[model samples]
Target chain A: MLQIENVYKTFNPGTINEKKALRGINLTLNPGDFVTVIGGNGAGKSTLLNMITGVYSVDSGKIIIDGVDVTKMPDYKRAKYFGRVFQDPMMGTAADMQIEENLALALRRGKKPTLRPGITAKERIRFKELLSMLDLGLEDRLTSKVGLLSGGQRQAITLLMATLENPKLLMLDEHTAALDPQTAAKVLSITDKLVTSGNITTLMITHNMRDAIHYGNRLIMMNNGEIVFDVSGEEKKSLTVDGLIKKFSETSKGMLSDRTLLSD
Target chain B: MIEFIQSLPSPIAQGMIWGLMAIGVYITYKILDFADLTVDGSLGTGGAVLVVLTTQFNVNIYLALVAAFAAGCLAGFVTGILHTKFGIPAILSGILTQLALYSINLGIMSGRANTTISWRNYKLIVSSKTDELFFTILKLIVIVGAIIAVLYWFFGTEIGRSIRATGCNQNMSRANGINTDTTKIIGLVISNGIVAVSGGLLSQFSGSADVNMGRGAIVIGLAAVIIGEVVFGKLFNNFVLRLMSVVFGGIIYYIVIALVLKLGLNSNNLKLFSAAFVAVFLAIPYWKTKMAVKQPASKDKKTVSQKEVKGNAAN
Candidate 1:
């Protein structure tokens, strides 16, 4: 459902800060493929996702989503095809807007906003029902400003927003890294339930090794702007954190520091 | 005190007119989260267009007001294009447009710095010289009320909500598939249009449109917005009521100015006073945040700091 061909991205070329973020990377995903990506810092994992979402243009590559080449598409345009959750909880929702208003905006993704009422009476009822499902008591605070919510609640709302329109691809970029462990687990479980029920195609980037192994049908390890390992099916299911770490150290030429790769 | 009381009506009328411009500023400043400097020039553009159409082309007063509003929109459009399409910073883009409009406004008035329209010869809508103060007040109230009503409805619409979202959180807006560039441009357009209309009304009421009438307009508008929020923000949380409060803020601002003038302050120092007034109010929130940060031992300090961080991100 998504294809990346010979994608190359270099930041600050010809300068002291020059760095090749991606180099001739190519990957393709089949329908309903759930991939978990793991890497150390500066592994180009986020860059790859940013390129796919058109947040940053690839220097030389084509991104095709659902058979349409969207390499040149702007971030907002590509947004219609992808549901994205950012690393920062605050990045995913407008703080000043009400809870229902944010949901209404998500529900209208890929549709043109018009002069009609922003939040309708019927939509409010639907929103309340959806919020209740999160069990966060947000249903009672439909008109409460999103800024008043905690980090975990905001991230949860963001997850709901991402799935509201049943996007073609769901992208999670360390979405729970900022939350406490308990809150992270709750959000991750919510993520699992939504993706499983909807059969949504997803690409999740996680720093935690257990989470990397605990979720998804496939797992890929990236290092130095290249995918070093790709494991799926029974192989991915049987893999343990220790084995994965051994493999990463070997493949990455022992560049995988214990602090960087093994930290949760 | 009696002199101040007698002078109250004139400033009140003028305040209502300036309140229209303040409302326009509120859209960009508060709603769009844009520090648009376009109002300083667009206000003059409105008055110039109105004066040129009414005096030179003999257009109907209402038509002149409409033309002035359109002219202001055009000015804002230029700033929006420069900011969004050319990738200029919004403040720089507004400054560029404001500079350009100065020359355009001059040309519109046929190279004249000031133009006067006689109430005796022209069918004026509202004027300070008119003996019927009741009629003038009623007319100003109706105009401001109609504008507030329209704006209240517009902000509740889908497009309006998107614009608000763009201001509140641009990253979230884009991820939700909103064309933030388009929304921002529309906001500037709407804001400048309303500012121009207020300029038109001011020109009519004061009997003349001066080239420099818009100088420091942004400061005055900000003062009104800050003052309104400071005074009535807690009580007036509803959107429409908040807008009404802005109008009242403008009136209070003018009344304060009138009182100071009555107390024998030099008129030339009014701009300085306005600048100082806005500066103090703008600093209040910052000071509060600083105080919050200082209380590091407090349990709720973390929440306050988080809010501060969020506010920074929104900007």
Candidate 2:
């Protein structure tokens, strides 16, 4: 479970570029809650995720994960409780390291690294099995540098890494946006399977309206640093893309074009 | 030609000693992806510590070397703290540490710019004054070999892998809960420690530790790394073999310098030559990417170009 209380974040305060990224935002997620977030550009969706992950400190707020207040924690320390996938495919893995090495690092998340062997013989076998499950032929290339992998393959591997230690909260920030449509679909399916099987609490940000509606048990629409709509259960399941667009237009008063949301 | 041949042994010995320094540079430059300028001062710190301990304190030669290594580690620790804790840029942090070490090295030499230890009175490990060139060469080789072996093993460990990951992708490392700042500091410490050891060895071989001994140490180390990668990179794919290539690169660099000196070039111009050599080699990959972009035929080529640009931006 995760809780955000009265979170406020402002970038470049008192300057020409001053902008309030988040303003008094509050949200909570129950155990095993799968939430999809949708918003136009600059909706503070990514900022909200960043706040939770401690990538950016909230100006005035508290972030509690699993009953521990981590608002003051550094990004790396906060990472112990969360599995995160970035929008950039290249951001989630060390390119020069081997496939198995990346996985081994992921397995040691929230644990101290010691002088032990980086990847043991037994761990290698387990990693090969895990890679084979992705069906990307990465099992055969355990020692191959991660930079050589395709974007889709890297995202899939990143997804696996996020769940390797079974995180308290899984955060996906447009993780599949960089891939082609077919590749994106494949990675999204992998994401669905992993999140469901592990019963992980997830907060996913997506720009595509169809995907926003297609996945997750609950959906929230954000605009101008605030959540404008929250729908769940049967209401979320029965919602259509057109209806969501109509609701967004009415709520934001046509400040953003529907073309941005309708492109997908 | 006979003169060049006769002088080959000395250059080879000096090269082997500097090869150790080059290996240290390789850790920060290639592995940690940091252009740490701390080596220029730390190398002198090593020699100063060794000379002070051996000549003034009358410590054992081996103990002097150990003291020198520890001194180098301390120097690197200062730089690491400056960069990580104080939020200074990596290059500036190194420069600041290097500037501080200059005075420290002088103080270690009892307010002198140079210190000499006589081989006749002191039990020396390796020296150019000794007539046994073969033995000196053999001893230096053994030391370099041991260092390379230790480093090869260290880089394969879990902590070492994390350091490598920290260099390659700080974002990924942090997401995986790695304290990247700690890893960077550790890397600088290890690198500077090795560099100091090399400096200590050089001071012993040359019979004195001069204040300006490490004036362009970073350049020579980089030259060795770049030259090694250019010549033997394709042939040596294994980690151990790659380290060896760096040693060989140092030897080759010294041999070339010796040849040029024998051909009547001034020894003072060696630094200029070294700087030019490293500049050219470092530009090769960038030039290759530019050429690839000009071809504009393959999607993979574009990707490589973009990746190179990204890498440049990151650096």
Candidate 3:
């Protein structure tokens, strides 16, 4: 479970360039809840995730993971409780390291690193087994540097890495947004399978209304640094792209300048 | 011609010693993705510590080298603290540490800029004054062999792999639970430690530790790393071989310098030549990309850092 308690963040406070990024946001997720977050620009969707992940300390709030308050914890310190895939595929995996090496690092998440061989003979076999599941032929390229892989392949590997240790919460920030349409769909399918198979507590952020509608059990719409609409269960499943866009427009007073939010 | 051939042994031995410093630089520059200027100070620190310990304290020569390495590690730790704990930039932190070490090196030499240890009074590892130049060269090769072997193994370990990950992709390392700041500090410590050891050895070989002995060391170190990459990048895919290439680069650099001197180039202009040499090699890759008739596959990789920029724009 994850808890966010009335979080607020204001960037460049008291300056002429000041902008309120997050405004007293509060949310809670039960175990195995796969939540998809949709919002227009400046909705503070990524800020909310960053707060939970401790990327930036919340100005005033508490973040609890698995019943432990981690609001004051540094980003790397609380990394044990969560796995994150950034909007950039390159952000999730080291570019120059080999495929198996990256997986080995993920396999030891939350554990004190030791002087043991980074990639053991046994772990190599396990990594191959895990890689084969992606159906991307990465199992055959265990020694290949991740930089050499295609964007979609890198994103697929990053997905596997985030879920490698069955993290308490998985955060995906538009992980497939950079890929081509076909590749994005494939990665999204992989994301759906992994989240359901592991029953991971996930909070995903996306701009595409269809993906926002198609994936995850719960949907929350954010605008102006606050969650404007929250829907889940039968209500979410019954909603279509058009219906969701209609709701989004009404929440923002029908001033929809960016139509691409629903174009996909 | 005979004179030039005979003079070759001294620089060859000198090259092997400087090669150790090159490996240390490789760790910081190539592996950690940090341009550490700390070696300029730490190398002198090592030399000062070694000479003072051996000549004044009457310690064993080998033990003195260990003391020098410790001194170097302490210098590197100061730089690490400045960078990681105090929030200073990596390059500035190194410059500060290097600047401080000049006074410390003087202090270690009992307020003297140079300290000499006579080969006749105490045993030395490798000295040009002795007629055992060939054996000295052999001993240095063995030493370099052992150094690379240990480094190769260390880099393959989990903690060491994390350091490499920190260098290549800090965000990914942190997501996997690695504390990158700690890793960067560890790298600086290891790198400067080795540089100090090389300095200690060079001081023994040449008979004195000078405050300016390590001047422009980072440039030479960079020169060696670039030369190694240019000469052996394709041939050595294995980790151990890659390290050896760096040492080989050092040897080649020294030999070229010696050969040029023999061919009538002014020794005073060597520093300028070295600076120009590194600049040209650094530009070669870019030139190759521009001159290629067909663009390479490596060009297709759209740099992935743009994702962070987009993430910022979205928020």
Candidate 4:
């Protein structure tokens, strides 16, 4: 479970470009809760994720992850508790490393990293089994450099690596936006399967409204640095893309915009 | 040819001395993804510190070397802090540190532009053998052995992998809970610390420390790193090979330069030669890829190749 209480983040305070990214925002997720977050550009969705991951300090607030207060922790310290998949697939993994090597690194998170005789047989076997689960045939290419993988394949590997240890929280920030539609769809299916099977507590930020409804047990909408709509259970079950767009316009004081609705 | 063969051991020793600095450069340049130029200044600064502490202050010679390492670490820390905390570019941060050390080094040398070892100063190699070359070779073996062993041990620890991971992908490193900024600082500190120690050794080897002795050191270090990487990259993926390759690169560089000098090449053109060597080593892969691309269009399979040759050369 994770809790964000009275969180505030302001960038470049007192400067000409000053922007209050998060304004007293509060949200909480119970264990195994898969929450999809939807917002337009600059709606403070990514900023909220960055704050949780400790990329930027909150102006004022506390972030509690699985009973551990992580508001003041540095990014690296917070990483052990959460797995993240970035928008750009390349950003999620080290390109110069082999497929197995990247997995080894992920496996060693929060532990002392050492270089011995390279990858041991036991580690290789475990890595192969994990890679096999992706069903991407990556098991056969353990020595292949990650740079040689396609964006979709790399993201799949990244997703597996992120979830290999089953961290307290899994954060996906438009993880498939860069892929072709078919590849994105495949990755999303993999994402759906992984999260549901592990029952991992996940916060997925997506630009697609349909995807917001398609995946996750709950959904939240944001506008102007605050959560304007938080729907779940039966309320979320009956929600449609049209109904959500209409609500955005009625409660958020703005049209949903063609791109926002079309993106769904 | 006999005389050339006789002079080979000295070059080997010089190579080992330069190898220490080159490995330091490799840490920052290859691993940390930083363009740190602090080696140019910190090397001389470290040498000056070692010389003054040992000769003037009458400090223990071994302790002076440790002091030199600490000074280098401090210099690298300054550069790292400037870049990470103040948002300065890595290159500019290094330049700033290098510029600041010029005066510090001079101050260490008692305002003299250079300092020569006094008669009573402890020598690093104290054999009574009349052959300077034999003594130098003996010193080289000891120093190189010490360097390789220490580096191998240091980089084998958990912290070393973290430093390497930080270099490979800083963002991922942070996401994985490695404080990339701290790692960057540590990597540079370790790197420059070794560089400074090498300078300390070099001062003893030359029996003098000049304020400007560290000029073009970055280029030379880079030359050694790239050449070692290119030549011996295929031998092994272990960190040990990486270190050995750096030493070999330095040796090759010195030998080539010596040969050039023997062929009536001007010493002043050393920088140009160094630059050219780095460019060629760096360009080897691109040229190979270009050649591969230009291959007859019959196959038209322009997929990204999984060739080690392609990747290593590109790097």
| lDDT string, candidate 2, B120-179, tens digits | 878887888748668889988888888888887788888899899999999999999999
User: Model 3 - which docking category?
Assistant: medium
Cα deviation at B51, candidate 3, in Å, is 0.8
| Candidate that would win on lDDT | 1
Q: What TM-scores does chain A show, candidate by candidate in order?
A: 0.98, 0.98, 0.98, 0.96
Give the poorly placed runs of model 4, Cα more than 4 Å off: A8-20, A60-62, A67-69, A108-125, A140-144, A242-254, A258-261, B1-6, B53-67, B118-123, B126-135, B138-142, B234-237, B276-315
Better of 1 and 3 by lDDT: 1
| Separate clash counts for every candidate | 0, 0, 0, 1
Q: Which residue pairs collide in model 1, if any?
A: none
Question: Model 1, B20: alpha-carbon shift in Å?
Answer: 0.7
Error (Å) of candidate 2 at residue B182 is 0.7
Could you give candidate 4's per-residue lDDT for residues B222-282 as a string of tens digits?
8888889788988857777888889889999888887888878898887888888788888
Q: Could you tell me the lDDT of residue B153 within candidate 4?
A: 74
Q: Report lDDT (Cα) of residue B44, candidate 4.
A: 96
- For residues B1-315, what per-residue lDDT tens digits would candidate 1 score against the true structure? 787787678889888888889999999999999999999999999998998899989999999999999999999999999999999999999999998989998999999999998787788888887485667789989988998899888888889999999999999999888999999999999999999999998998888888899999999999889889999999999888888888888999999999888789899999998999899999998998888867865767777678666543332
Ranking by TM-score: 1, 2, 3, 4
Model 3 off-target regions past 4 Å?
A: B1-3, B292-315
DockQ of each: 0.57, 0.57, 0.55, 0.34
